[model samples]
Target: MAVSFLSTVPNLLPIVPVNASITSAPRYPTLGATVRCSKIEADADNEERFKRRSILTCFGATVGLELVRSSGTFVEMAEAADLIQRRQRSEFQSSIKDTLYKAIKENPDVIPSLLTLALNDIMTYDKASKTGGPNGSIRLSSEISRPENKGLVGALNLVEEAKKEIDSNSKGGPISYSDLIQYAAQSAIKQTFLASAIRKCGGNVEKGNLLYTAYGSNGQWGLFERNFGRADTQEPDPEGRVPQWDKASVQEMKDKFSAVGFGPRQLAVMSAFLGPDQTATETLLATDPEVLPWVQKYQRSRETVSETDYEVDLITTLTKLSGLGQQINYEAYTYPVKKVDFSKLKL
Candidate 1:
């Protein structure tokens, strides 16, 4: 989807389909562009994009895997939500969706511009190093200009599109743009996990069957849910909120996340995902030579180590960074889903 905007306007980005999953949710009766909300059929092509939010986002109408995986659109989303309401799925799995609804019903105004940083896994970060700059600075215009954030404009503009549609259709009550954007992201994560669960067990996808996420080395987390209610901020986030990968060393990244209640292992997990996915393997080495080291060890380990063992280790550490046991909900900050190897899918 594309939005035409005057060229002279600064900081106003044109809404384009940067990430496919975040397509237009369309206003009530009319069909918007075939944005993420478009009612699409599920198939193999969709599966490749549907599986992971750490890199890209894809949208589809149904939820299933023929030979692989695919995404879920409003239709499948409604079905899964209905199933969850009937207790077939855990309430925890629907936290993201629930939060969006709650945000719209309560403080609808904060919906737009609130979900900017919700997608920490977006691979738009540039390799530019900035150790010399302040860590948590929120210079809006300058922030967007940073090399690390080069490709993020597309998602940024999407915030406006989601806001426009949801607010217009808000007769049931308006929804802020941020709510829809956050919903789209969280929706992708929930659907991908649930889709994989259905692929494995061949039953209704819900907390009952999707509780495969292990918490501690010996214990397991019943489900993954993200909290909501992030209010929109007038300025960009402070510089230090996200890791300064281009400038900071691995230890710095660990320290930064650790300062906010995360640990080194979780930092490692986040680092593994920051690899430039848009850069192909042929060019990945040269595109960002530094990234390979962080993920290389894990990928190489995948070759010799048991895939389950490696994955379990990653998930266990990820529990900390991804809010494994934290008491977060729609009224609080949500956990970020670190990338997991989707290749292990049974399908």
Candidate 2:
């Protein structure tokens, strides 16, 4: 028998009330011990080693038990297990992406909120301290209640609804809140691009999907999709980690962006996430000497029907944003399946 890690887990975490507030919270905890934010950086070599170790570990524990009693050879069983994991992960990816697309399409109002939720979740990183980034701490009531995260509870609730559907269909276990939030944002952005194409085509859904699919760069979204297995933070992040978006000055916004290694071009391209109106945001940001040129450049790209330049930049930025301070579990979505076909055996 293959080792089954499948177990009944709760579909969603218990949500804290949106109105809950925790004043006087520290921005980052200092419990007389250093927290290593960069300790688990994901790299190519590290990922390869992790995958190899996981496969070998699982294979060792199960092969002996099955090899003695079963007809399947060790190589065949191991290959079957690896194949099952890959197939399951790919199917889950498609399933969850479909769920997100349906959720966003049926209720287009959630797009801005979803983008903001994802943005707030990621912006908590302080590169100087190397702490906090897209860990889903924003799901905590205390984190979302902050001034910067105002009007975001709706987005969180929407994600919770999607989570229920996703977890119900998941064979492994519940999807992590951290992964869901970032992925929902990615889906929302793609939907936004689709919406633009649909509008240009006068609400022709078929043509819009085809046109965008043909014109859109799958490589960009693929970059974001390849990253998974983000764990959630139990405690709310330290206060003041996110910027007060509605009230922050242009320079203040610039400083925050710089802290995360973003430049004027990124800031200009991501203006839609900063506010409801991308054009208005560009107009406001145009006042900044450093940001004006990029804003103007993207505005010109917007003149084209496809807005390909803007779409490419947004996808690239979002892909990077979703991974800030992340330590991915390359095997998170891989679940077990029947290793041997006993029914085929001639008894």
Candidate 3:
């Protein structure tokens, strides 16, 4: 979206009354003129300061993007993105509660697969180096939850779950971390599209499109596809590409994205597309309180949470927030079925 400014007056002084006889005329400033001048000065200062703030915010967004790309945190981004999708879909499906819970329980593996796909896409094409080489090892779990790693924990949770499932099903076979990473990466990219749609409908910023794109791209997972035949460079690039959240501006956001080959219109469109699902839980919570507590407890146990947790927590938090349906009715919303236009997407 285009950044808007409050109205301001011109700073140039008004032309003096022209008189051939008098070289100088009595200069009298009108009351409106003085007020306008003051307003103009204040507006100028505010715009300047806001510009700086925008740069800082953009920087913060960029850093989030880098963390996901470099740290193999695609799974976390997917989780966050899925939460948004679930919330959106819940708005249309009548059996959303059961569906969400069952899906959460059944496909713990989905997130990891998605995460891996996203990571592979980014690292494969971008100039940045892959973090964990065959010899260079790092703990994916710990890195996924770092403060600098905002917007990625959700998908990572899926990866953790996938590992557990693999261990359980293998009957003692070694689980493949590499495979999980590839899957999670893929899921993250799909989630970006889903999250963008929710945000367009006015969902919360915490689960918004901007964060999804920021985290996904900053980490280099959401980059454009290039010729696959290019040779792989073993060396890693410098780290300045990632933008910081608190110190970024709109211009900075535009600049950084442009540097990666995205334009202002594309950035704006993406920003308007995704967001978190805020009301999904509230509806569930309002419907059933007796079963809500257990759900909330289960959700809190994980370092990273998901829509399933939110669904469970909704029931739990609702019970705690308000009494059972004696006076309130908490029915889950239906899920949406309309597909978004993918052809219009820039990223």
Model 3 C-alpha lDDT per residue in residues 1-347, reported as the tens digit of each score: 12322223322222211221112222453433321211112244344444445434434444554454445457876676567654543332213223333444455444433332222222212223322221101124443333323454564455566556544543223234433343233334345334544454467756555544443332332121111111222343223433432244556545654544445433332221112221332223324343245334433432232333322332222122111111211121213346799999999
Write candidate 2's Cα lDDT for 1-347 as tens digits. 11122212112111112222223222353433322211222345345433434434434444443345354466687887788776787788899999999988888997888988999999998788877999999999888889898888988998999999999999878899999999898888888888878887899999988878887765667768778888888988889877876677788889899999998888988898886666677778999999999898888886677788988898899889889998988678887665698889999
Model 1: per-residue lDDT, tens digit, 230-287? 2333444434345534444555555555555555444443433342331232133323
Task: Please provide TM-scores, in order, for all candidate models, with all chains considered together.
Answer: 0.36, 0.75, 0.26
Ranking 1 against 3 by lDDT, winner: 1
Q: How far is each candidate from the true structure, as Cα RMSD in Å?
A: 29.7, 22.2, 25.4
Query: What's the lDDT of the predicted structure labeled candidate 1?
Result: 0.38
Clashes of each: 20, 1, 73
Q: In model 1, where is the ten-residue run with the lowest total lDDT?
A: 58-67
Q: lDDT of model 1 at residue 241?
A: 45
Q: Which residue runs of candidate 3 sit more than 4 Å off their true CA positions?
A: 1-147, 166-182, 185-240, 245-247, 269-347
Evaluated at residue 336, the lDDT of candidate 2 is 62
**C-alpha lDDT of all candidate models, in order:** 0.38, 0.77, 0.34
Rank by TM-score (best first): 2, 1, 3
- What is the full ranking by lDDT, best candidate first? 2, 1, 3
Best by TM-score: 2
